[model samples]
Target: MKKYLLLMTVVLAALSFTSCMEELGSYEYMDANEIKIDSIKGQSITQYDTLRIVPTITQSRNTSEENLEYLWYWYKSGAGENAKIDTLGFDRNLNYYVAAVPGLYSARLKITDKETGLFARKEFDISVEAENSGLLILSDLNGNANLSLLNFANIFSQDIYYAANGEYAGTNPVGIADIDNAGTDLHMIAILCADGRGGVVTEPTSFVKISDYSDLFYVMPQPIAPEAYCAVAVLYNTGMGITYDFIINNGKLHYRDFQYAAYEPLFNPEVSGDYSLAPYAILNNNTLLFYDNKNYCFNILKCSYGQLKETKLDPVPLPEGTDTETLAFDPRNVGLEMVYAAKGWKKMDNDAGYAYGIFRKPGSTDLTNMYCLRFNIGYNMSMGRDYFTPYFKHSISGATDLDKATAFAMSRQDPYLYYAYKNKIYSYDLEFDKGKVIYDTDTVVGPGARVDYLYFRPDNESFNMWAATSVEGSTEKTGSIHVLGLGRNGDIVKVDTVYRNVCGKVVGMTYKNR
Candidate 1:
């Protein structure tokens, strides 16, 4: 029985093998001769950047041995959806310039077999960064304004509005106001001027949106009295699509277009004298902080975004005899909202330190819950005596007493505060409560140079400080703009005198992202 089963199994296997061979012989095949497009990948580009792409055509067994034709085009979405696709020359390699406004874009490449009727297509995407980013130097040319532009790509200055626009030509520019508008391209620049500042107009003009190399766009008007503005700042609330341009002129604070009238004279009208100090003020955390030099107090007003106008001037209560000119609001302090200011009438206060305080407003109440502290101690006992030592070889050497707060710049990225006194720069560490002289302008700008203004570059991680120093008794009012590079810990790393022989004293300086 076993032999008979084995015989039957062998016979069945033989019959199956023969059937499989017959099925394989009857199968049909075709040649692969079609043309295919090579996949193209997406790209990222900056505005005005050149993007080069090369595409290849894949040929199969049936494809003809003929030259291939190519075409490339790109288009952007949004309002430019109806715009024409920029066509490139008939070439396999595309060298395109990404000059369009920053946005997402789509591009296509087409290939055709010249000899055969076969064709193929490919598509890809691109992202471009926003343009018009640079630094604007408002050269107060002895009252006549000269707008000097310094793009990141270049170090030298270029007069962006000199002969380009007739309106800004030979105009006396008091200062320029800039606001960082989130989301939209509403970031605008307003050249503020008055008859006193050597400007053609007596009052400030509307904020002008810059286009195509400082060409003035439509102006966003702000109500202003025919008076010279001492300080100006633009507050933008992108979430609510509202903007307010604030200006301090003739000892009055004005905002919006007469939405509400100016703050009811925060200063004493009896003080009839020329206060040469430019009104010191800054916009911080949705609040406008200004110094009432006439009253010797700090004034705070909670700004309402997108409100057509303010109904009344509700100022946060502040102690009188506060030094507004020496006020420095530290943006780095998040938890404790502290503002540092040199206390005026030092004899009355008798405090060895500047009058700085932390304040908080609760709920809907206008009252400010506050705590004031005088940080007069310069040397930290915990770190020993030498730990607070500073390098003073070429710059102002020696220890700095924190009592004379004078003019200071607050670092946004670190706990260090840079203060200028006489011709020396001092670094004060808030965390350790220690202070030391970091840089001296005595050797760099000659003996009699007095450091007046200090500015911290907001866009730089290195915490680069720009200082303006004027010679004590120079007849020409000659000064120099020095750039000091600081280390991560906020110590002076290097120094460079970028501008020298400045004819006029620099009243104020701030970094503006173009």
Candidate 2:
């Protein structure tokens, strides 16, 4: 009871503080000017808990509500693609009296109907990161359940548990544990920063429900690093964070003390010019690509001690002629698509500059002849004049200093990268040249600095991500920790979100080896 009260009080106080904060002067109440969005601006990650949800919500008329009906939606995933999978029709204001489950699920609601008997339905796919997935359910610490593992990857057999199988019942078993008891395994283990609390299914018939404990996984030392926050589930094997550990425990995963190895790059900037570095990383069979906007000519950087070395994949010129900003290696080689951004320019592309392009080049080893993204600042980050790159190449480019290419951990999913800019997250589909918004702060920016610190846990099948939003002096006191759900077909679901209103600063997030 005491723990519950403390948690509630902390969350409520934070919520109040956020609401009391003043709005920026740049954004004022404009009665005349209006920015209308045909759909919700960016309904990226939704949540079940209201009070715990950091950014306070009031009202907004900036969206198009013509077709949005006052209806409810619920789905196992965030994509509202298949209505059947995304079941609809439920309570209007109050869906689940309490936050439904701790796992990530897709759901949204529309106001009232005006045109027809039904109102317009604005179904924006949202990831709900239940904030309490790791908290032990005090009421049922003894009641546990066991799950029969379906060896799709290794343990293949006739027995399998599908969505049709009444959802996974049985509690208080042994061996198996829930990284975080989110009620439903809507999120696979390590799908997002490790929930820590999950059911454990052991060989000798043992299981432990995730709801049994709050300490599913914990960082080893005094203060935990921010980057050890949330990790995206891609290749469970590769564990890395900006400044923390992607540790594992008894099959569960979370942050812990680990080794730190920093080295410098071996190569130097010898390209078309001294272009900003934009190295790329891919995950899930090159289906996704992440980029950093360093705009340096080189990509791979081996940091040893305080020195950094650049390992060149291709031979090029100097930092004089080119005006590019990023580079990438589609880990799967797939050679080229092996891409980089912002090429063919003198400097920041003074004359409206160049439009960043995704290109391909040669590679080392068996990584060749694949789809490589190639272009000079003259033809950068763009397919053609008709379609533009998601982001531009100019400083005028919305890219922030923090906007640099993200070096994906050395894993099977090498290229599907994770990065943040202006404190927003975007996942790129190299195959489709498409960008998906993972989290957005147009709802609430400032008072905090948003940086991308993602980590992956091998055992728990989850990853953690953190956005440092609030600060004091030079200290970061609050952050919205988000869990990324890795599911079928590069599908993403937000498991949960939490704000740490404590004393800490997010050091460049990276995972440490134990």
Lowest summed lDDT over 10 consecutive residues: which window, candidate 2?
A: 133-142
lDDT of 1: 0.48
Error of 2 at 276 (Å): 10
As a whole number from 0 to 100, the lDDT of residue 365 in candidate 1 is: 18
Quick one: best lDDT, which candidate? 1
lDDT of 1 by residue, 127-234 (tens): 664453445555555555555543444353434555345445233445554544333334444455554332321111121323321122122222222232322222
lDDT of 2 at 488: 33
What is candidate 2's lDDT per residue for 92-182, written digit by digit as tens?
Answer: 3333333443233445555553433433344444434333222111001123221222111222121122122443333322222222211
Error of 2 at 395 (Å): 17
Could you estimate the TM-score for every candidate? Answer: 0.51, 0.25
lDDT (C-alpha, whole model) for all candidates = 0.48, 0.31
